[model samples]
Target: MQQLLVVGDIHGFPETFVELLDVGSFEQRVLQLADLSGRPGLRGDNLHDHLVKKDGLQHAVRALRETNGPPCFGIGFSSGGTALWSAVKEGLEIQALICVSSTRLRFETSPLNIPTIVFWGDLDPHRPTEIWNDAVPECCKTYAGKHHDFYRVDALAPNSPLRTDIGAFIESVSGLHSGGPAPAR
Candidate 1:
């Protein structure tokens, strides 16, 4: 069976957001970074400051490494995505990656070998630049909202367009619709 890992943003995974994804069939694992400790209210500069001071991303990468096992599909939000990307670079096995609003990836220049996709809101000021988008191995999609909008409680309506697109992408990457194995990008 396929394993699916979900990494939360700095604010951690909200219950509503968790319910938005379709992971019923896969063996799933969820990570809430040590820095946040399940906190969900931090925002703006406070969030950035706290993460930087706590070396949150590095901790997250460590946590991922400890849990590392067979190749799996990964979904990460914001800083969590950066941690996963870093973990992949450090040799944690992953078949594919889907990152949402992971603006920090703008600094990554090295190409990833596996299939990967990224999602960001068009209105998010911190969204990655054209150069990063162009360099990524797979698709980069933009939604019509600000940063964090896609995962917000109000935006997680069951059939929201963002959720639909994300679900479709997961299916395609995991080969859920096709009997064949996932593709190598």
Candidate 2:
């Protein structure tokens, strides 16, 4: 079975994280990254820098290294997505990446070796579609909604279209078991 590490936005763990990851196939397991906020040592000043670099990516690495398991998959939203990519950029291994509403994606010269799927709302003010398109190519999925629209707390589950897209994307990469899936036409 595959394990998925869910990284939430900077606002902390979004309620949608659990429900959204629940839509995956049984072969995949879900682990939502802990919201270190509201905790004693992690509460104030430089929180972003602290978690993003020295302290942040470790969570994923620890999760993957626990029990000497295989490289776990990643699902990140907004800043969480940034953390996921940062882990990869810093040499942490991930089987695949599913990023939603990510504003900044550090592009390197080497063609990305991992399979990546990016989802940005058509109405998101963060970055234009062209940027995401250029970054992820055909692997980007644009929905008829906004940044926070992909997942909501009160709903019984995540949006249906998003669910289907996520499930399909996960399955699409099952073959690689390494990098991201090819762009879907």
Candidate 3:
């Protein structure tokens, strides 16, 4: 089976986020990347500072490239998405990308050629602006809540529309439900 790379937000993958995704089903086939130091519980501005202001993003890209050498499907949350994006630009092999609430992408002028999708809440003030959306309107999806809704258990119940959509995307890209061989990485 093809592996999936999951990158967590600055807060890391909270229990709620993990539970909502029922990640255990594919736990063995998933490679999860988080804080640059592999430390837990880093949040808010401090984590942002470490990741962006301190060259941690480059470190993360390097770590990602070293940890997962083959092309694969990826899901990145917030700043983690930015890291994944950078890694891809810097030659990390990734077939597809799903970025949720990666607001910092607003500054990205270059487009990624791989199959990619971005999700953010309608109320997220920091979401990419019209220009960014215009660059890839079809790849952008908006939910009804605010930023971080994807990390909230209550906001993303297993049966919720957002969860269902995300599951479908994963299945489509990974061919998990097709009974056929997944595409070559």
Candidate 4:
């Protein structure tokens, strides 16, 4: 029951955020660099580069579904939140969802009955807090801060409250972890 965490829309952030990942860091950066070098990486292109990470997330989810261990918690950031919501709606067994700076991709009656936490940077260029605040269900909580504030880089040091807020939210909702063993894909 290892909970599979699926991250969302990293875009080109991986190119410089190599220090974040503990595993597959180099390879992931190389792939992102390759994708950025080509025209396919442009926003909304829906090209081969997009599918690369898309496949990766899907594979990760499939593996988590197959695992039979401690109940796992899944966290999705930014566009990753969108994907997480999709998985939950599709009936993918997950303990929880932590979406940051993102929203639902389409308008549908979501089947996501699980506890969901949303972290939106107040000043994010794309997914601002106002856009997602009312859109998400009450079960989901949105943090008001700045874009990339979660990473705590110098650019966002002024709005460091987001980091602490996220930590607190996780602690508050962790007790609600539930659902049976993740189902097979």
lDDT of each: 0.68, 0.57, 0.65, 0.43
**Candidate 4 residue pairs in backbone clash:** 1-68, 1-69, 3-72, 7-80, 8-79, 8-80, 9-80, 122-145
In TM-score terms, candidate 3 sits at: 0.77
lDDT of 1 by residue, 67-171 (tens): 756788887778778788888888778888888888888878876888788888888888877777877648777776555545654235777655666667777
Predicted model with the maximum TM-score: 1
- For model 3, the local distance difference test gives 0.65
Q: Give the count of colliding residue pairs in each prediction.
A: 0, 3, 0, 8
How do the candidates rank by lDDT, highest first?
Answer: 1, 3, 2, 4
Q: Judged by lDDT, which candidate is best? A: 1
TM-score of each: 0.79, 0.66, 0.77, 0.52
lDDT of 3 by residue, 1-185 (tens): 44567777776554234433432244322333445535344576676777777766777888887764456777777887888888887887877887878888888886787877777888888888767876852366777765654544532566765555566666666555633332221
Give stretches of model 1 more than 4 Å off: 15-17, 35-47, 178-185
lDDT of 3 at 83: 81
Q: Cα miss at 119, model 1 (Å)? A: 0.5
Query: Which runs in model 4 stand beyond 4 Å of their true positions?
Result: 1-8, 12-70, 104-111, 128-132, 139-145, 148-160, 176-185
Which candidate, 1 or 3, has the higher TM-score? 1
- Model 3 stretches astray by more than 4 angstroms: 15-34, 37-42, 136-138, 154-156, 175-185
